[model samples]
Target: MRSRGCAEFSIPCPVDLRKYLSESEKCGICNLTSNYICRFSMKKNEPFEETLGKTAAQMSSQKENRNCLKGPLVLDFLFAVLPYSAAKKLFDKKFSIPVVSFTNLGVLDWRRLDFGNGKINDAYLATAVKHPPSFQVSVSTFGGRCALCSSLYATEKNRRVAERFLDGMIQELESAVSPSSHKAPAKSQNNAGGGSSAQRQPAGQQEGSDSKGERADARDKGKSKSKPKRKKTVHQK
Candidate 1:
């Protein structure tokens, strides 16, 4: 209840909207305490909210629903790597765009429309991580002509960029390959076993040290288990 004295003509009356407490009762004491006590116990207060706010919560919910729609949306578009010649062949096969002389077309950089086609705002050949192990130049399209990159390699730069881009991608993936660096744990895993590699570590080492040590200890643990089985058989014999 609001902390105000209950003596206002405009005060809402629960008895009925049309009824009012008598003017004579303004000074006369009735059961203000009981009335307030009953109201507090019976009535549920409305939850408090900021006076002014624009909710991003509703907008976020709407965005999530829209994301569920089929195919990639404009906002969800991603760069894909494909061979330059293959990409050109695809465009040539699908669309009627010509893949003739390189000089007639303006070489695309960041600013210029990528291909002469009005659909593509820009085109470039660059190294990317999308293709791993081997470097191969692939055409990239943005804005509109991105759809046509598969059919034609229009500019000299496009071909070179594609080649360079593939080179870089291969280099990046290869760099991640350190000799003897097995990506998976060497130990055999069980179908129902819940234990992770971390859990296999001996108790004394810190987690950081345990990670490297676990691999080294794998063979030792196997030998230890086999030793226990052999010892039991020897005792029985």
Candidate 2:
């Protein structure tokens, strides 16, 4: 949202309380989730860490106050005393849907989803389709790797924008985990020594060379019969 020029926005995050329930209170197949909306503002060129800390603090406060449980309690009281139509109307008038949302579905279990045939290489959870001007991003993990999926109502222009947004998000996450100092030397070496430097480069020393000659020496000594394999799967909304 900040990247799209929206300085302020609110996102509703679902809070599941099933794990907090007593064993006797654990009813089967029921919706035990509520949510709290967190409003945030992004200053120009703000550091990601500052934003992350603020978000964490807000969520912690909400959790400490048991805000998630209050939503359900309020709804139950409203529907209990008021007529169905009156309650519905009141709820609609009081709450407005947000334009942006995010959800994390946590890790997926491959064994449970298995069909007993081909292996489940990778999987990601996708959010429900949202109308124009509304967008949602969901994440899921499988095989120790995280996957992101997005959903939105799109025009040709909106589709292109969504693609670019997701791409930028991926790059941002990558940069957060892998620092620039770790990435720069490999790119510099590749540029300096031409195509031959790439094939003979070792995984650990890819970003370690100070000069072209050192890079050439590392490349020559680091040759292996088989290169490490990397698997990447991309899912577009």
Candidate 3:
């Protein structure tokens, strides 16, 4: 860009780069088009920290469902990528979006996502090296913990740098959710479903009685141990 006498500049809108494709798609109720992607620029800046803060706060507070970062970002990619990639054939110019993409799949229910064989161990995101974005970040929360996963396409010369960048992000997040700063969860909501102490009184009393029996059995064993063994004189015959 500096060689072109500009502080920042973009390459000749890579035209005909993706010419072997269609411009529209129809899937059930979704009718996707390529018109919007032709002039799209993925360089738009979104304050990640602010977005993360709001989402985290809501989740921690036990708020309702949040169709969060993953839904919008991934759905947009699903609807747009193909059409945009095919734009080179339809028009003379192909569009650009963020070189670096980020998506947060907030707190998923693994039990529901399971497919009977077993539960999902983990989930991840990735990108193509031939694609514009060289780096991407994907986040998800599960088992009361957060996973910050990243993907990067890099050559030997830049692989270390990419690793460092990703490591830095993970370290920062770990610091944010440090154990010392973490708060204990409030009383379980399960207790509200007629499972409170009053409702459990009978069970508790039975358990207390069981414990008393156990104590009595223990006392009997002690008494048996305390009794001196009867000595039998050996008969000469």
Candidate 4:
């Protein structure tokens, strides 16, 4: 978001309420999700640790207070007591969906995903494609390796922006996990031929981790020297 001149933003994170509701068992026919909005404000050149701490605190507080359940409960009541059309209309009028969203699908079971025909090299969660100005990013882990996928309204311009944004995200993640002594220099965002392309790091090469995983690489020849102005809000849902 900082790359897009967004300093303040709110992102809604889907919360799984099954554990809270004592419905932990998997049920293919049921939906057990709710959401809590995470609001963030970034200071100029603020350390990433501060941002991460704030996000963790906010999410923890919301979950402890059971705030995520309110939306689903209200919707359930409205549909149960009112006519279908009336309920739908009322809900639509009262709620406004955010333009940007984020979700973490958690770790996928490799054993279950196996088809017994061949080994799966990689897997990631893809979000639904949305209209213009709306975007979503989803995260998943497979075999101790993290992956990120994003969906948005596509145009030549928008696609380029999204690719750059994802590339920035990957760089941030890699820096966070890498040792300070071996940290690489920041790369320029305006580099030619840059895109959100995954590059697999050798096993035990990244921070001494044993897992071999893919990371987005946006090759660059220079460094970014300027900070962008705060101009937009990133709404995540």
Q: What's model 1's overall lDDT?
A: 0.25
* TM-score (all chains, Cα) for each model: 0.17, 0.67, 0.36, 0.69
Q: CA lDDT of each candidate?
A: 0.25, 0.57, 0.34, 0.59
Q: Pick the candidate with the highest TM-score.
A: 4
Predicted structure 3, TM vs. truth: 0.36
User: Total clashing residue pairs per candidate?
Assistant: 21, 0, 3, 4
lDDT by residue for model 4 over 1-237, one digit each (tens)?
443434676779877777775445656557577788888787766666677788888888777787777788899999999999999999999976777788888877767777989456455566666767877777787644556666555565775566557656665654555424132235543221222224322123322322332222222226452221111111222
Model 4, runs deviating above 4 Å: 1-8, 20-32, 179-237
Q: Name the candidate that leads on lDDT.
A: 4
The parts of candidate 2 lying over 4 Å away from their true place are 1-9, 20-32, 181-237
- Model 2 scores worst on lDDT over the 10 consecutive residues at 191-200
Ranking by lDDT: 4, 2, 3, 1
Which model is ahead, 1 or 3, in terms of TM-score? 3
Clashing pairs in 3: 42-96, 42-97, 42-98
Query: Could you tell me which 10 consecutive residues in candidate 4 have the lowest summed lDDT?
Result: 227-236
Candidate 1 residue spans exceeding 4 A from truth: 1-152, 179-237
Supply the global lDDT for candidate 3. Answer: 0.34
